[model samples]
Each structure stands twice: as C-alpha cells, then as structure tokens.
Target chain A: MTDAIQDEIIREFDGLEWLDKYGLLIASAKKLEPMDEDSRTDENSISGCQSKVWIQSYKRDGKLNFNLDSDAMITKGIMALLLRVVNNRYPQEIANINLYFIEEIGLKSNLSPARSNGLESIIKRIKEIAKNEALKDNV
Target chain B: MTGFAKDFPILEQKVYGKQLVYLDNAATTQKPNSVIDTISDFYRTDYSNIHRGVHYLSERSSERYEEARKKISDFIGARNPGEVTFTAGTTDSINQVARSLEPSLKGNEVLVTGVEHHSNIVPWQMAGAKPRAIEMDEDCNLLLDSIDITKKTKLIAISHVSNVLGSVNDIKKITEIAKDHDVPVLVDAAQSIQHLPLDVKDIGCDFLAASGHKMYASTGVGVLYTSDRFSDLMPAKGGGGMVDKVSLEKTTYQEPPLRYEAGTPHIAGAISMGAAIDYMQKIGLDKIEKHESDVYSYARDRLLEMDNVTVYGNTDRMCGSISFNMDQIHHYDAGLIMDKMGVAVRTGHHCAQPLMKSFAIEGTVRASFALYNTKEDVDRLIEGIEKVEMMYT
Candidate 1:
C-alpha cells in the first residue's frame, strides 16, 4: 500500500517540470505581497528559509487548503510545486504521503544541499500540521 | 614591487592556467620565503620542548622560544615580555580574556560595536556579560555619539578596523572615553596591526589581541598584550608551565602570561612569527601602510565610477578592504564568476553578521590587500567586478 502511494507521488511530480509547467503558481508564490494577519502567517512565524517564507492554511469543506508565500524567487517556486500535490487533501491523506519519492525522481541530485534541506524541513512541517489536524478530527 | 611579489612563492603558482591574484589576505596572508625558511631551520637544526629540559638542545630551544616572546612584545610595543601571552590566534586570545575577566566584571556591562568580527563578539557574550553595541553611521563609521561611557560599563571592546567595511576607528579616543568612566578597554587588532601603526601605550587600551597569519606570519601563533598593572587577574586555563608549584592539595600559579598559557607553546610557530615581524620591519610598515591605502583608494574610486555597483564603507577613510555589490547579482554568484577569472575575493558576511543585519544585506564580496599586492592586482579585481556587473545587470 505504501509503495503504491509512493509511486503515485513520484508520477505526479515527474509530470510537472516545476518552473516551466506551473509558471503561474511559481510567480504567485514568489511575488507574495504583504497581506492582513488573517490572510497570511506572521513573517516571524516563517521557518526553514535563508530568505522569508509565509505559509497559511485553512480547512475548507473538511479538506486542507494551503496558500504559501516566500520572499526568495526559487524557494517560492519550490513551495508552489509542493503545494500542488498536497493542498486541499484530507488531513489523513496528506499525513500518509511519502516525500522520499522525490529522491527516486532525482530531485535531490539537482538541488543544492542547503535548498534540499530547506525543502525537507518544509515538507516535515506540513506533515506535522496534517497529523495534528487528523488527531483533532478523531478526538 | 615585482621582486617583492616573487618573494612569496605561492604567487608564482598558476591557477587554472592563470597566475593567481590573491586578494583574500584578511583571511590569511601568504607566507614569504623568509618565514618559510625560519620555520624549516628551527625544525631541522634545533627541535626540543621548551622550558622543561636541562639538556643542550632543550636550553637552546628554550632561549629561542623566550626570545620570540620578547620579539612579539617589542613588535606590539608592550611594556614587558611578561605582558605578552602566546595563543593559537586572535580567537583563542579573545576567548582567554572573555573567560578570565568575566568573574571580575560582575554587575558591569561590556560595550562592543556592531562592526566587530564574530570572534570578538561571541566570546564576550558567552562569558555572561551584557553585550551592548555601539551604532554605526550610514557610511559605516562608528558613531561616537551613541556611545554612553557610564560607570556601569566595565569593559569596552572594539575592533581597530572593521574586517568587512575596512573602516579604522580612532581607538585612542575611544579608549580615552573608557578611561574617563574608569572602564578598561580591549582592542581587537587582528585587522589593524598590519596596516596601521599601533603602540599599546599610545592607545591606552588595557588589552590588545592580534593574529600572526593576518600579518605575514605563520598560522597557529598569536599574541595577547595585557597591562602589567592588571597581571593579578585570573586566567581562563592552567597547566604544565603555567604554575610555579603543583600538588594534589593545591597548585600555585605563576605570573601574568604564564598563568594564561596552559599547554606546551608552539615553538616553531613563535620562531616564524619573529621572522615574519623582521621581514615586515625591513620593508618598513609605514611604506606598506601607504601602499595598501593607495590600493584601497584607487579600487574604491574606480568601483564608484562603474554603473550598477554599490560599494559599502567610507571611501575617504579605509585600509586595504572594499565590500561591494553589483546590481541584480548574488554575492556568491559574483564570487564564482571572479574565481573563474583567477581573481580571489571573499564572498560572505566576512564574519560580521550583525553588520550585515544593519545593512539589510545577505552578504557582500570583499577584496582585501596585503604588502605583496600591486596596482595590477587591483585592476584585475576591478575588471572582474565589471565582468560580473555586465553579466548580471
């Protein structure tokens, strides 16, 4: 079952070239203009970036919806690509998704060490949020 | 100038089929032939542990080791050889001072400038003293107006010249202010000792620390100069040669310097440092100082003439370093481009992260100079910067 889920994630990420296919998502994430506290997370709350990153998520119709922002151009593009797969998924579904599928797709080979670590950190945080939400639903 | 340049053997080596244009002197200066020969001679002829043996070789090694101490004392114009304590580098020396002096500084504040290198700032912070910062102006000069020398200020630590901005502070005046408030001052002279004429007495600083490698000497050797009056203060470490007598019950420590130097000293390092100082004296520090200042002035002026280039620090007052940025280019990218051109420059915070925070910049490309550097080197650096600006902008 885990292998099937991993294969699906690898296929999805492989279909998207990140910078070329989803250019709009990349642009929107890169040009993250300031918004009200209700619309965006505090800049101080942003984590795991050499530059600034702001991630805001809400539950819509019993599914998680994410609107992510980052000050760095390339990092924003990466976050946008990540959000495409995990956004608007059920909390349990998001928590169970495997990120190591990226390594099989050769994503880690092309990225610098710092960028790779940052991406891993962001993925871990997202998974943590999903697990918390799933636990709350069970309770 | 070419003859002097050839004296440094590293300059003769080709990097990627091009002659190396080394401008990373602030990180570490290339050793001349004389310094290399001095270390080789000591190891080849006389090799023994110092101050612990009664044999002929031991006596000779001990004399040379102690003579090196005297040479360092004279080089920095310290009052006595006893005032000079040997350490690994400026970082170690500053650590000693911070750890040893913190106990005496209870209920007192330690003032430092934002322009200090991490070595000078972090140790004091680790020592449990409240570290206050002196602000810098828009031009990166230390704003003396912001310094409030109150009685609570037990220690005032400042760098003589900023490693990133290359701005030389008036340490004498700053020390005078500290004196009026009855606070002792520690001057981090790692960058300034080579480019500026320094006299501990004239500056009136209570303690001064400098590295050997930054001033044409070998690595693993440095000096910490303390005033004789404050010799009674405790040292951070104690061991082998530092104590007069030792027993299981109690150990009595020696005088000021011996108390601070705990382990077996770097004998060959001390000898080569003396030789490096001899080479600098022969070339005349005044002449080298003027030469480096000229290089900085020429580079700063030429960099300002280029479009889409932003240079940090005051042009009118600087030593041998210039930090700048080309429009739309990351500092790491610029550094990579320069490296391909066989021009070396430091690309980072230059260990002054607080100063980078003040400028709201990630980092800047720094080109630092030395006595062996020539006008052609500066031109190569400028050309490389121009290439980076053209490529990015």
Candidate 2:
C-alpha cells in the first residue's frame, strides 16, 4: 500500500521541472482542507522548522485523519504533499508505513534541509499519533 | 574593475543554466584566489605547531602566523599586535570575553542593542548575566536615548553594523556614552568589517570582534581586539601552549592575547586571513565601501520603485545589504523562486529573531552585496524578484 502511494506520487511528479513541482505543491496547499482556528495550538505545533507548522490528528473508524498547515507557502505546499501519502490511512498501516515519496519525488534534496526536517517531523508526529491510536485500540 | 570579479573563482559557475548572481555576502563570502591559494600553499609548504617546536619548520610557520597577526592588526588599525587575539570566530571570541569577564561583574545587567545577532546576546546570557536590550526605533535604528547604562550596568555590547538591517550604528558615540559611565564596551564588528574601513582606535571601544570568513578569508579564524586596559583580564581558557611555566602547585600563564588563545590556534586560517586582509588592502576598503554603498542604494531605489515592495534599514546608513518583502508574499517562497532564477539571497530571520519580532515579520529576503558585485547583478535581482511576483500573483 505504501509502495502504491509512493509510486502514485512519483508518477505524479515524474518529468516535472523544479518550478512545476513547486507550483503543484503550492496548488496542493491551496486545495488543503483548512483546519479550525481553535485546533492550531502550541501542542500541535512542530519546532525546528524555519516556518511555522501545525499538525492535528484524530481517529475515525479505526483510521487516523491528519490536518496540517504552515505559515509559509512552500512549507504548506510541502506539508500538503506529505499528507497526500498518509492522511485518512489506518493507524496500524500509518504506524508501519515508511513514506519514501519525498525521496522518490526528489524533494528530500531539492528543498532546504530545514524544510526537509520539518517534513520528517510531520511524518514522525503522524506515525507517533497512529502508534498511540493503535495501542488505544488494543486497550 | 572587471578583473576584480575574476579574483573569486566560485563566482564563475552557472546555476540552473543561469549565471549565478550571489547576493548572500552577509552570510559568508566567496574567497578570492589569493586567500584560497594561501591556505593550500601554507599546508603544502609550511605546516607545523607554533610557540613550542624548536625545528626550522616550526620557526618559519610561527613567524608566518605572527606576520598574519601583524597584518590583521594593521588591517584594523589596532595600537599593537598584542591587542589582537585570534579565536575560532565572532561567537567564540564574544563567549571568551563574556566568560572571562563574568566573574568581575559587580552589576545587575549587561546592556546590548536590540539589533544584535544571536552571537552577541547568547554569550552574556550563558555567562549568567542579565542582558537588557536597548530599544530601537520602528525602522530598526538603535534609539540612543533609550539606553540606560546605569550604575547597575556592568558592560555594553553592540553591533557596529546590524546584520539584518545593514544599518551602521554610531559605535563611537555609544562608546563615548559607555566611557562617561565608566562601563566597558564590546563592539561586534562582524557585519561592518567587510564593507567598512574599521579602525579600533577610532571606534574607541574597549573590545571588538570580527570574523575572517565574512571578509573573503577562510572560516575558523577571527580576531578579538582589546584596549590595553581590558588586556589585563585573565585568559578565557587554560591549555598547554599558553603557559610560561607549569608547576604542580601553580602554572604561570602568558599575557593577554596568548593567554586567551589557549590552544593550538587556527594557523592556516590565520595565514589565509592575512592574505585576505592583503587582498582587501590591494583593493582599498574605502573604494569597496563606496562601491557597495552605491550598489546597495541603487538596489534599494529600484526595489522601492516596485509596487508593494517594502525595504528595511535606514538607507542613509546601510553599507552593503538590503532586506525587503513583497506584498503578501512569504519570504521562503520568494527566496525559493529567486534561487531558481540563480540569484542567491538569504531569507529568514538572519539570526535576529528579536529584531524580526519587533517589526512583526517572520523574515525578509536579504540581498547582500560584495565588492565583486556590480549594478548588473542588482538588475538581475530586480528582474528575478519581478519574475517571482508574476509567478506567485
């Protein structure tokens, strides 16, 4: 399933120039579902990012849903790209899945390390949330 | 001079099929061939430890290193080479002073300008001193009137030029104020040294720090200049080469500069720094300063002409850097687009988060000029920014 998603993302970005990829990311950001103002709290905020980013997750019918936003357009766009691979996926699947889409799409090196680190943190936080949700299901 | 740009080899490259327009001089400068070759040549011919080895290589290397020190001393117009101590960089230099002087602080606070880089502020805080920031005007100019250097104030540290704003602070006046209060002043000259002709004697500050990398030299070498009075302070660190006589009970230490150097210094970096100073001398700082000022003003004027473009800094005082933002455009987005267009500008807070927060901005796209940069480069930046605006809008 992870491979399928990674392949889809790679296919989506294949043969696109750097500017085109950036435009697509920005377009994805424009299409992202806006999170409630109240949900954008410090608890959901991620540090070590040059731009401000917030991610919130909730469990629904054994699946975890994610919502993320960033103050900077590029950061928001990157977050939107990452979410396309993991959002609305099962907790166990999300907890176990390794998203290689960033590397496959050449985004791992294309963007600055700070933004890449932010992407990693977003993924890490999502996985952590999924892992917690999986444990709660067992309990 | 057309031949001047040829001195820097890295500027020859093309980025994304476009000739690279490097405007990130404030971050770190591309080294000229002379500085680069000096580093390599020193390693190839004269590589040895100084102050201890009795061998010929040691003596030659030591003499070269000391020669480098004398060059830097002359470069900054210091009273003597004894007043200059080589450190890793500006941050290391400031930390050494802050740590060494912390024990003697019989006061409640250390005063710093609000526009200081993190390097200047963090040291005083790390040394357990309460750092009170002197207020700046809305335009980010230091409000000299807001400075309250009271009896409780032990030290006043200020940036000679603001890293973000590129606004040259009145260090001489600030130093005089500190003098009237009998408080010592430390001037961080990291931003000013490259674009301005600096004379420590004229500045009249007790201490000053500057990095070599910012001035066309290799990294890992910087200078801490102290007046004769401040030179009496104890060494910041203790190590092998800095001692005169090592005893079981007590070890006699060397004097001020050597005392603070403490360990095996950055010999090649220091030598290369001297080469860099030589390069700057050959070009003449007065000429470089004027050229940069003209280029910066030209860029600022052109940028201001653009609709909804907001440029920062006091234009009358800016040396070689300009920070600006386009209407409703994120700095990172603009920076990314500019990068694609092969114009390297720094985006983000520029290690001046306090200054950014004061202006209620996340970051600004900073296009800083070097002596090698021409009006053509500024035009390229202006065109690239226009492209970014078009793409985003």
Candidate 3:
C-alpha cells in the first residue's frame, strides 16, 4: 500500500548525492530529542546493531507512541525518519504498514543481515511492540 | 615504494565518485594479478580432487597442490613441507590446534596477551579452556617480565600483531620463556604474515597459524605449522582422505600433514597462495617491509598530529593498523562519512572486546595499511577525519 509519509520521504531524498543524503540524515539526527542516560539502560538497548540503539514506547490517547535513539548519527537519523512514519499511530495500523521508503531511499542495502546496521532488527522490534500493544487492546 | 597499486585491478576503481582508499587491510588484503591468474589457470587446467586419484589429471593436480604446500612451507621457514598443514583459515587452524590438544587444553588455561583478537580468544573457549590475558601497561605494551604462568597454564596462544591497534607483541621472547617453563606456545600470525617476514623455527614456537587471504591470496585456505614434537597429536577432524586403516573396531590416521587434512581441500586456493608467495618474493620481503613500515609510520604520525583525534595503542614497532577516535564522535558515524569520501576503514570492537574493555570504550575507527597503500591514502583518511570533525562542529 502506498503511504503518504513514505512517499514524502522518498521525494525528500530524491536527486541527492550520497554525501548530501548523509548531510540530511545528520541534520535529522540532531533534531531528535536526546535520550536521558537513565532511560538508555541495558534493558532498553537493542542488540545486534553495530551502534548502540535504545527504544522506548508507550500508549497515549488510545494510540501508540514511540521514541528511539542511537549513538551513531546516521542510525539516529534513520530512527528519526522511522518515527515520523509510525509514531502516534494506532497499534493495528503500525502492525500492517509497509516501510517502502527505506528501499526507495537507497537504504534497503543496510537492512540486510550482512550489514551490521541492524535496520531489520529495529523494524522487527517495532512490529513486535505493535503486535503486543494491539493484543492488549483486544484484551 | 613500488607501484603496487596498479597490480591490483580493484584499487583503480572509484567509489562514491571518489578514488577508493582502502585502509582495511587488517580485515583482508587485496589479491595481486598473479594470485588471481593462478586461481583461474588452475581451474582451467589442473582442476581435480587431490590426493585420492591415480590418473594423469589427478597426478598433475596433486603435484600442483604439494608444490603449493612446499612454497608455503618455505615461505614461513618451516623445517619441511610436512610441518605445514593446510586448513580453511587462521580460525580453522587455531580450532584445529584446540581440537587436537583438547585433552590437555580442557579445564586448563591458555595464556594470551590483552590485545588478541576474538579468533585467538574464542577457539580456546570453545575447546573448554579459559583464556587469561597477560599483563600489559596503559600503552598496551606487554610487560614480559610480569608474565605469570601457573600450573594450569597448559598453552600460550598469542597474536604477532594486534588487528585493531597494530601492537606488535614480542612472540620470540614469549617463546623463550615458554621453553624454560616447558609450556607449548601458539603464535597467531594472521596479522603479521603479510606485513613482516616470519620464521617459525627462528621464533621457536610449537605452533604458528596464518591465513592465505590476509597474505594477498585467496580465501578458504590457510597454513597451520605444527612442530615435529606434535607429530603424534590426534587428528582434530576424521574423514576419508585422512584415514589410513578403518574397520568396525579400529581406525588409524595418516601421518603429519596428510593426517591433519581431512577431506578434499581447496586445491585452487592453495595454488593461489603459491602464486601470492611468488609475487611477494619477487618484490622482496625486505623491500615490502621497509615500504609498509614507512607508510604505516606516516599514517600513525599524521593521525597523532590531529588535535581532534585520539590514537590508540603505542609501541616501539607497529604496523598494519592504527585505531583512533575523533573528539565527541562515534566511530560508526565516522566510518559511514568516510565511506562516502571513499576512505574504507573498520569500526567497532573489531572482535577484540577484551581489548575494548581494557580501554573502557565502545570502539574506534581503525585505518589499517597494506603494501599497496601509500602516504596519499593516509592523507585521504585525515581529510575524512576533518570532514567528520567539521560536521560535528
């Protein structure tokens, strides 16, 4: 399914060279709210990534909200993009949405198991969180 | 320095609209044209399973394989070709030693330096042995006089060069001490085989392990040099070609090198190693060592001169790799930006978690050098570091 936010991301990255893309990502990374040291504990840390990544989630106003942070700027930048597409969305909506922008923006290579970026692992964790939240809503 | 960059066809290419400056030689060295041609030529002509056939083609293939073994045997100064057994790589060779010496290594300790890579650390753990790091000072220099070998220290496995920090440990001194204690020592030469001239006999180590890929040859082939003292060690792996007499109740294995080689080996890869050795020899190891040392020192000096960068590990003699980090910058981020600038480097713990713990840091950006890399590559790396620092500012 076509997503408006995903399409917008693809358009934003269009016609940019590799260095420019990285520059944009670094800027987005800076825009993300800093994660506190207490919240960046081992429990919140995501393993299998080359960089240190932490994720937090909570339900607000019957919708799921998420926050993610990484020590690496490019990784945090990608997390910023991901939050724009899925934050504050209903659990059921998040569980079924396709993040095609990752592929369209020349980042699909980083999602492979071979690459140490752990982009796939982050996406999986997001889906798992959405499924659990959706199940709790049903209960 | 010789114009070796032209010999590697892959170095001429452009990455990200810039000249690719490869500084990840510690991970793997690029193969020369002679090595590449040797692999293809072997496949085109002498492509057959070795040591098991009796036909003309089999004889030719077996002859070529043994010839490669002889070349390798001489390259590392083995007493004879029989002392060297071809394995998959350095990890495989180390695991073979661990497996063959399982009876002695299990429940014992293997003394290692604080700067060993995981390949040297993990195999001993998998073999049911604990790895204890020898004492080293803050600069990551091994304090040989402070080495404590206990009764449980059955073996000492150390790396000749640190893959992450490029600290060259004095394995010869360790061997001398190990001899007095009657404890066998294993030298991991995966990082040293390409950059420095090595002699197993001169080093007096019981076992030495090195990889073909790291020495500008093909992957899937390596050498495990076992001293004649360990000739009777049990085979780590049991298979068809390695066996001599097999029955329902009894099985006997082949002798020395063939005894360790379990199945059909990488025939072409081994031949490629022969070509790589020939290529390096023709260029002269003395010349290669001098050139690489010059380039390596220049790189280290330039990185040290950078005010915003912190270089890791210091030693009187260092080569192959130099790890550094910029002020308030993550190594992964620097590596990503450097990749865009066509300066390929390695970032992370570099499979040396213990070393990382000693430094109390997550990781560092490692720029490893090879014979082909020149001062120009180091200049490119400095530029990449400048770009990262500017981005942060």
RMSD to the true structure for each prediction, in A, is: 6.0, 1.8, 1.1
Instruction: Note the DockQ of each predicted structure.
Output: 0.07, 0.65, 0.80
Q: Pick the candidate with the highest TM-score.
A: 3
Stretches of candidate 1 above 4 Å error?
A1-139, B1-3
Q: State in Å the error of residue B81, model 1.
A: 0.9
Q: Mind giving the per-residue lDDT tens digits that candidate 3 earns over B231-300? A: 9999999987888999999999889899999988888889888999999999999999999999998988
TM-score of each: 0.78, 0.96, 0.99
The residue-by-residue lDDT of candidate 2 on A23-138, one tens digit each, is: 77777787887777888888889877767789888777778888899877777887887787777788888899877787778777643445623666777788888999989888
Task: Give Cα distance to truth, residue A48, candidate 2, Å.
Answer: 1.1
lDDT of 3 at B37: 90
| Cα displacement (Å) at residue A93, model 3 | 0.6
Which residue pairs in model 3 clash with each other?
none
Which of 2 and 3 is ahead in DockQ?
A: 3
Per-residue accuracy of model 2 over B141-230 as CA lDDT, tens digit each: 778876788877889999988888788888998988888899999999999899888888888898899999999998988999988887
Candidate 1 lDDT score at position B326:
78
